[model samples]
Target: MMITALANPKRFLDLSRTVSPWTCALAVILLGIGFYWSLFATPPDYQQGQSVKIMFVHVPAAWMGIFIYSMMAGASLVGLVFRHPLADVAAKSAAPLGAAFTALALLTGSLWGRPMWGTYWQWGDARLVSELILLFIYLGYIALWNAIDDPVRAAKAAAVLALVGAADVPVIHFSVDWWNTLHQPASILRLGGPTIDKAFLVPLLIMIVGYTFLFLWLLLLRMQTEILERRARSLMMARGA
Candidate 1:
């Protein structure tokens, strides 16, 4: 009910305008503190030296990449089943952002990998391959939306694709353990608590919070932009008609 009400473009626009600045502020502050702690405050690893610092950014990005996709898929499902306009908007808004995060994860992982695994790229790794597939899924959703002329049809088709891609999130999550890959197993959120040292963990936790806020900040901006664009397009079409 609330989502449907906010689906009114004017209401959404007003809400987004009011909230965007705060989100941006939070994201910036968190990112600054996170990087400072990651680079200067965190202690070097017992094994990986300073290279382990990459995890500060990469791990959070990887988490966001998976987390955003799942959210997109869930929103897509809601749009498809409940027919909520905001749900489709949320799902559509998530695509480009999720793609960027996934790309970041892959790039940062490669940078970290070169130092740790002695290679920047690998073919047989399940986690890497699954994540790469995730990027493609995001792109495909965007493409599907653009290819269709009618917004309703586009949303339905894209929603289906997004839901299908949701299955891969689990695959990405378990890939490290399931496959004999170079990627490390889960820490922090795993059983028996985090195995990471406190010094390094603080920076990592800070970075994670930073990355999460950044995602929220970007998502709000993108969704608001999309809402405005759609409204403008609708107005233009009405005038032409």
Candidate 2:
């Protein structure tokens, strides 16, 4: 019911205007605290020492990379099936942000890997390779969106790409378990519960929430821009007609 109502562009714009500021404020506060706690409060890992601090950024980024793509897939599915006016906009708006997060994950993972694995990258590592592929998928989706001149055709093509690319998400998640990889298995989210200490877990969770809110804030802003651009285009077309 709520989604159906917000499907109206005006309502979505109004709601986003009202809510985006709050989301931005909350994200700032949470991220500020999370960073401070992660850098100062938590003790360094006994083995990895100071280098373990990278996990604070790397882990949340990796989670968001997968999460945002999943969200895009869901929105794409809606756009393709129901033809909701804003659905394609939402998916399209999220693509660049998802790509950025995925890129960050890969970069940070590589940085962390250099010290632990003695190599910046390993082609044989399933987790690493799958994550790299996910980045490529994001790029491909973005490229597809720009390849076509017609918005409708582009949206449909991008939607199909998003749906098909979603198959990589699971592989990335379980890569550590299903194959031999240098990446560690799930420590925080697992059937057996979190294996990490409260010191690390607490800040990590906070950072994750912060990142989510940040994504929401950015996504809303991007959607607003896309909507307004479409509106402008429609107006210009009407004037020409």
Candidate 3:
């Protein structure tokens, strides 16, 4: 019910304007706390030592990359099926942000891998390959949206691609489990509780929450801009007519 009410473009714009500042503020605060804890406070791993610090950044980015794509898929579903207003806008607004996070994940993962795995990147790793494919999928979705001239047509076409690409998400998530991959399996979320100790886990959770809030802040800003731009374009068309 609340979702339906917020579906109106004007309401969405108003709400976004009101809430974006708070979201940004919260993200900044949380990220600051998270980084401080992770960098200075958390004890280094006996095994990986300082190299483990990279996980604080890389893990959150990886989580956000998948998470944002899932958000886009859900928005695309609503747009393609129930024809929810602002659904396409939400999906389109999230794409670039998702791509950035995905790229960061790969980059940080590489940085982590160099000292740990003795190589910057290994193509043979299933998890790495799947993650790479996910980045490509994000890029392809954005490209498809830009390829079409008509906004309506672009949205519809992009929705189909988003839904199809969603199938790959699970593959990426389970790649470590499904195959013999260098990437670690689910530790925090699984049958057993997190294997990581409180010293590391606490900071990691803070970073994850901060990353999530940051994405929401950016998503709202981008969606508002899109809404305003479209409204302006419509006004120009009406004036010309």
**Model 1: lDDT of residue 218:** 86
Winner by lDDT between candidate 2 and candidate 1: 2
Task: Give TM-scores for every candidate, taking all chains together and pairing residue i with residue i.
Answer: 0.88, 0.90, 0.90
Report the alpha-carbon TM-score of model 3 versus the true structure.
0.90
Candidate 1 vs candidate 3: which has greater lDDT? 3
TM-score of 2: 0.90
What's the lDDT for all of these models?
A: 0.79, 0.85, 0.85
Name the lDDT of candidate 1.
Answer: 0.79
Error of 2 at 192 (Å): 16
The TM-score, computed over Cα atoms with residue i paired to residue i, of candidate 1 is 0.88
Model 2, C-alpha of 20: deviation from truth (Å): 0.2
Q: Name the runs in model 1 displaced over 4 angstroms.
A: 123-125, 171-194
lDDT of 1 at 158: 95
What value does the lDDT take at residue 114 in candidate 2?
A: 80
